[model samples]
Each structure stands twice: as structure tokens, then as C-alpha cells.
Target: MATLLLTGASGLVGSRLLPRLVEAGHTCRALVRSEVALPDGTTGVRGDLADPDALRQAVEGVEAVVHLAALFRTTDEDAVWRANLDGTRNLITAVQTYAPRARFFMASTGNVYDAAAAQPGRETDTCSPTAAYPASKLAAEALLADSGLTWSVVRLPFVYGEGDGHLASMPGLVDRFGLHPAHTYSVAHHRDVATVVGMALAGTFDGRVVNLTDDAPVTVYEMAAFAGQPIDGSSEPLVNPWAGRMDSTVLRGFGFRPAVPTMQAAARDGIL
Candidate 1:
């Protein structure tokens, strides 16, 4: 089993993923800014991604790194860039110096795609994100590509499940952002994320950028209804129908299958 260093161990995704990684028989170490309880057998290092010494200690002797930390849903552009881009650079540099041979896996977002795309966002698509969060994540991806490290990036769509309340928050976000009710969005369950990362840990996705999503895309109206916060329906023509959809052909070709294939399946299984 490989020794792994995981950043963002206390966040939504990381908190759920750490236990799975530990259960997979890997020794896990988490880098955190403060005291936080982590999965048993997973060590927590008190440090920030901006600190070189802390990162150096985190990466030392680790065989893999899963980067799940990111700044999302914030108005502070500088904080977003610093945490997403600059912090990624710090971690990459530390890993390069301390554990050059380690495999690196970073969690990215599907929002990096252009909003007016004619088709589902594919790995081969030219991304020109207008939002701060996705733009910062794209910039971070570029930095990792040039770092000369063995790395892979998984672009995640709307992630939900394990009582994260991400799905339940859709109505509020739609109202605040004036989102089109008919606009379809791709989604992935937290368990599916664990599956993809498990494959990455086994070196199945080395040197690749894979988009992770379920079998079907769901509309905002449906999501809002599912969350028990139904919103007004709009019959007006949708401007960005494919805005949140992603093509997961690359991931499928790698023999990846989402355990929770759709949001409905998650609901039926009582996992959402």
C-alpha cells in the first residue's frame, strides 16, 4: 500500500473521501490549517497549503497526493486565486522537491467549460471560464501540467450525496444567480468520486484529465423539485443548455462506472 497525503481533509469532499482511502488499505496523512478530527489511521498535519515547511513535512515519504481543497462560492477573487492557484503552486513545488516520484491527483470542476458550448463539455474542449472559481481552477491545472510531475485531474460536476446538502442548495443558488430552470447539469455522487480516486491511486488515470459524471444529466427544475424547494418554471428558450453538462467518455473508456449512476438512484438508495 502507498502512503498518501491528502489536502482539504476537512472539506466536503475530502472529509468523505479520507475514510474510503483509509479503508482501501492506504496510509493517509491530511494537511490542515487547524485541529480537526480525521479518520482513524489517518494522520493530521497542522499546516496550510501556503506554508512550505508544512507542505514539505506532509509530502515527505508519501507515494501519492489527492488534492481536494479549493475556494468555491465566494466573492473575494483574491482569496480564491490565492487559495486555488497560489496554494496549488506551493503544494506542487513542495511535492516536487520532497517526493518527485509521487503520483498527484487534483479535483477540478466542470464549470471550466465555456457556457455557450454546443455540446457537453469534453476533455478536448477549449475552456474559457468567466467565473473566478473555475478560472482559478483552470489556471491551477495549467500550473500542475508544467510542474513536470506525474499528475491527473478529475473535473467533477455537481457533486452531492452523503448528506452534503449540495443538492438541497440548488434552489437558493438558482434564485440568486438567475439560472434557467431548464438548463441541464451533470452530477456525480460522493461514492463515485471515491471510485474514480481509487482508480487514480492504482495508476489508472495517470497523465490524463478525466471528466467525472453520472449516466444522465438533470435539469434545475427537477433538482429544485427533488430538494422540496420547487421554483417557478420558465418556458423561455434556454441560453446555455449544456453549461453544466460534461462528457465522461474518457472515464468510461478507462472502465470507470459510477456506483450511483443518477440522482434518482441516489435517492432510491437513501444515500442522498
Candidate 2:
């Protein structure tokens, strides 16, 4: 069993991952900014991601680290930079100083690629992150690479499951905006995401950028139909499109396959 330190344990992915890791007979520790209830046997450390000293304390003695704490978006670019870029630098530095040999896994978004690009984006594709979220993630990936630690970066597509507010709640958006059927995107279940991370922590893959996504792609109109909601024709143009279909061959080679496909089924099963 390995001692794993997870940042952002209060978030959707981390919360799901913690229980799974425990069930797998691994000891888990979480670093959080505030006091929160955690499962028995799980340790919690109160600290900010920007503080290198606090981050070192959280990472100390763990065999592996999963860095998932990141700000998705912000009105101010400076806040985005500090939270995503500087915070990642702090964490990387702490890992280097306090736990140099520990394996590091980072969660990145597929938005780092240009949305208008062709389908099935490969790991080697040049990144063109137009938005703040992807830009920060790309920057963090670079920082981690330079840290001289064994690291794996998972560039995730839209992840949905129970408690997933963004992708899971899209059916309501379709209803409200009256969207169309042509808007399509790829997605993976939250459990699948956790499973991929588990594989990474287990040292199944090394120094690779794997894409975590499902085998099939689904459109918003189909999702609305699955939810038994009316597909409106008016809100088609306002939809923000995803990057593109992602190639998951690397992840599949590691024995990671998504259990759920369509967002509709994920929502129906309460998985998203």
C-alpha cells in the first residue's frame, strides 16, 4: 500500500478518488484550505497551495502526489495566474524538496488544444490554449516537467458523474437556451477519471501525457432528448464548443476505459 497525498480532495474528482483509494487499501492524505469532514483514516492538512512551506508539509512522506487543485476561470487574470501557475510552481517545488522520488500525477484539461482543430487530438499535438484555464494547465505541465520528477499528466475531456455540476447540469441549459442537436463533444465518467489516476499512482505509466475520455462522442441535443427534455432550435449558436474528440489509445494501453459513454446515461444513472 502506498501513502498518497491528494490536493483538492474537497472537489468532485478528489472526493470520489479518496474513497476509491481507501477501498483499494491505500492510505490517503488531503491538503485543504479550510476545515472539512473527511472519512476515518484519512488525514487532512490545512494549507494554501501558494505557500511552499505548507505544501511541503502536506506532501511529506507520501509515496505519490496527485495535483488537482486549480482555478477553472476568473474575472481577473492575475488571480488565475497566481492560483493556477504560481500555485503549481509552489507544489512542484515542495515535491522536489520534500519528496523528490515521489511519483506526481497532474489533472489537465483538453481545452489546452484549439477547439477548432480536427478530431482525436494526439498527445503530440501542439497546444493552443485560448482560454485562461487551459493556458494555466499547460503552464503547470511545463513547470512539472522541469521539476525533474517522474510525472504523468492526464489531459481530460469533459468529466461528468454524480455531483458534476457543469457537464451533468447541461440538460437544463439545453432546455433553458433551446439548443440544437449538432453540438457534440467527448466526455468521461468521474469514476473513469479516478480509475485513470489510480493507474498512474500504481506506476502503470510514466512520463506520458494520456487523454482520459470515452470511446464515443455525444451531442447536446441527444443528451437533452435522453433527459426527456424539449430540444429547442433557437440556442444553437451560443454554445461554447469543446476542443475536439480526444485519442485515448495511450490510456487504453494502460487498461483504462470509460464505463459510461453518453452524458444522458451518466445523468440518468446518477453517475454524472
Candidate 3:
């Protein structure tokens, strides 16, 4: 069992991950911005990502760091940069000084890839971030590369399940973002996401940039059907062109299998 320093313990993925870490025999020390109780048996320390002293305190005697903290929906570009980029520098500095030998795992997004590509995005594919959220995440990945630490990054897909409202909001999101009915997107269940993190902590894939996604991509029409809402197909030009697909072969090559393989499976199993 290893001692791990974790950030974003209060968020969706983090809330799910903390308990699994404990059950796996790993001790987790969570970094929180407020005085919130962590999953039972784990410890919490109040801190912002940019506070070096706070990071230092939270990182003591840990074998690894799992960074799931990031700004995804804060529309302000500068706020996105500050949280996703500048805050990363603060964590890096603290890790260099206090936990240099610990393995670093960053939660990244598939959005870091070019959305216009013809094929599913792979780790070796070129990155062309189209928005502030992805751009900032990519920048943080660069910072981790230069931090001289042992690291691995997992680029996550559109995550859902465990009562997360992402799937339920698809119809509204498609309308709000001008998405097409035929658009296809890769997805992963929150259970599999937690499993992937547990595997990362076990050192299954280190010094690697792996994409974690399901085996298939779902079209927007299917998404609408799943949500019990029908949509008129292609009212606007398809803006996201990558087929919204990610190749998860590398992750499977590392001995990982998704528990909930598709949204259909999630809905049938009452997880959606």
C-alpha cells in the first residue's frame, strides 16, 4: 500500500476516488479549499493549489500525487488559466522540494487533441487545443514534463454515470453548443474512471500519456434517445470534427478494462 497526496477531493471524480483508495489499502491525504470532511478514514488539509506552504503541508510523506483538480466550466479564460496553469506551477514547486520521488498522475482531457482530425485521437497524435479549457490543460502537462518528476497523464473522455448530470444534460448541451445530431463522442463511466486511477497508482502505466475511454463512440441521436428527447439532425455545420473519438488501445494494453463500457450499458444498469 502507498501513501498518496490527492487534490480535488470534493469534486465528482475525486469524491469517488478517495474511498476506493482507502479500500485498496492506500492512505489518502486530500487537499481541500475548505473545511469539508473527506471520505471516512482519509485525512484532509485546507489549501488552494497555488499556496506553496499549503501544498507542502499536504504532500508530506506521500508516495504519489494524483491531481484531478481543474477548471472546466468557468467561462472566464483568465480564471481557467489561473486554476489550470498557474496553480499547477505551485504544486510542481512544492513536489520538487518536498516529494521529488513521488509519481505524479495528472487528469487531462481529450479536448487537448485536434477536434478536426479524421481518426480517433491517440497519445502520439498532435495536440491542437481549440478552447481556453483545453489550452490551459495542455500547458499544465508541459509544466509537469519540465518539472523533472516521474509522471503519467490520462486524457479522459466525456465522463458520466453515478448520477452525474452530464448525460441528462446532453440535449440541452447540444442545443446550447450548436452540436450536430450525428456527432459522435467517446465516453467513460465514473466507475471505470476510478478504476483507472487505482491502476495508475499501482504503476501499471508510468511515464505515459494514455487516453482512457470506452471501446465505442455514441452518436448524438443515440444520446437524445437515451435521454428520451428527439432532436432534428444537423441544423448547424458540425463544429467538432474529431468524431469525438479516442483510441483506448494503449490503456487496454496496460491491463485495464472498463466496467461500464457504453452509455447504453449504463442506462440498462441504472447507472446513467
Candidate 4:
């Protein structure tokens, strides 16, 4: 059992993940900017990512750091950079000073991959993201890599399940991205995210950038229908067939297996 400092505890993923970590016997200290109800047994450290003194207090004596705070789907580019890039830099500095031995786990996005790639995004792919959110995350990844801390980066795809409504939001995203009905994208369930975090605690993902997703990559049309919010169907050829897909070979090689393996399975089990 390790003591962990977790940022973004109130976010979609972090809120769900904290309870699982507590249940797993790890002592979780959540860094929060405001008063929020945390999981039972979690210690809330009052601070945002920009506060250096607060970051120092948060990381001190922790065995690991789980960074899940990031800004996306916003029109404000400056806020995205401040939260994703500048925040990461500050956290890295704090960990380097206060908890140098702690392992770091950063949650990144699969959107960092080039939109026009011919195949699913791989860890070693050359990424050139034009969007602010992904660009900032990619830059943060570089900072962590060079920070010389034992770190792991997981590029998450479309995360859904546990009634987070992330899947339900896809119909509008389909229209926003101009994707064909047949365009497939990778996704992961909240439970499977907990599973990956467990792996990080066990030192299975150190010094690696892995893609996390379910076994089957599903199409947007199917996902929308499954969510009972179907988008307009299309037979036109997809311009970017591989836009939101990712290669999960590295995760598989690490013996990672998702608890929720498919969105259809999730729907059938009433977990979606």
C-alpha cells in the first residue's frame, strides 16, 4: 500500500478512480482547489496546479502521483495551456523537490495523434496536433519525460460508462468533427481506467507511453445508437478512417486486460 497524491479528484475520471484506489488499500490524497466531497478516507489537500507551496505540501511523502487534470473542449487556448502545460511543469517541479522517489502517472489524450494518420495512433508515432488541448498535453508529456522522474503516460481515448454522459455527447462531436458514420474510435470504460491505474501502482507501466482502450474499436454511428442518441447515418467514404483510433499493442504486451471490453457489452450489462 502506497500513499498517492492525485490531482483532478473532482473531474470525471478522477472522481471515479479515487474510490477504487482507496478500496485497493492505497492512501489517496486528493489535491483540490475548492471544498468538494471526496471519497471516504481520502485526505483533501487544498490547492490548484499553479500553487507551488501547495503542490509541495501535496507531494511530500507520497509514493506516487496521478495527474488527470486537463482542459479540453474550450474556446480559451490560454486556459488550456495554463492548466495542461504550465500546471504539469509546476507539478513536476514540486515532485522533483519534495517526492523525488515517487512514480508519476500522467493521463494524456489520444487526440494528440495526427488527424490524417493512415493507421491507428501508436506510442511512437510522430504527433503534430493543431488543437490547443492536445498540443499542450503533448508538450507536457515532453516535460515529464525530461523531468527524470519515473513516469508513465497513458493516452486515453473517448472515456465513457458509469453514466458519465461522455458517450452521449458523441453525436454532437460527430457533427463537429465531420466524421463519417462509419468512422471508428477507441474508448475505455471507467472501470478499465481503474484497472490501468492499478497497473501503474504495481510498477507495470513505468517509463512508457501507452494507449488505453477496450478490445473493440466501435463506430460513431453505433455508439450514438447505443446511447439512444443516434446521429445522421452516412454511406460516404470517411476522409480520416483512423482519426480517433489507437493501437493498444503496448498495453496488451504489459498484460493489461480491460474489465469492460466493449461498448456493446457495457450496454447489455447496464453499465453504460
For residue 130, model 3's alpha carbon misses the true position, in angstroms, by: 3.6
Tell me the spans in candidate 2 whose CA falls farther than 4 Å from its real position: 171-181, 225-230, 234-242, 261-270
Candidate 1 lDDT score at position 263: 90
For candidate 4, the 10 contiguous residues with the lowest summed lDDT are 170-179
lDDT of 4 by residue, 1-272 (tens): 99999998999899889999999999999999999999889999998999998998899999999999998868999999999999999999999999999999999999999989989999999999999999999999999999999999999998998999788888888779676889898999999999998898788979999999999999989998988988888778778889899999999999998989999899999999
lDDT of 1 by residue, 213-246 (tens): 9999999999998888899999999997888999
**Which residue runs of candidate 1 sit more than 4 Å off their true CA positions?**
none
Kindly list the per-residue Cα lDDT of model 3 for residues 34-125, writing each as its tens digit: 99877777988888898878899988778899999999786799999999999888898888889899988999998888877878899898
lDDT, candidates in the order shown: 0.93, 0.79, 0.86, 0.93
Indicate the residue-level lDDT of 191 in model 3.
88
With candidate 3 superimposed using the best TM-score fit, by how many Å does residue 164's alpha carbon deviate from the native?
Answer: 1.4
The order by descending TM-score is 1, 4, 3, 2
RMSD of 2: 2.9
**After superposition, which runs of candidate 4 have C-alpha atoms over 4 Å from their true positions?**
none
Error of 1 at 174 (Å): 1.4
Question: What lDDT, from 0 to 1, does candidate 3 have?
Answer: 0.86
Q: Which one wins by lDDT: 3 or 4?
A: 4
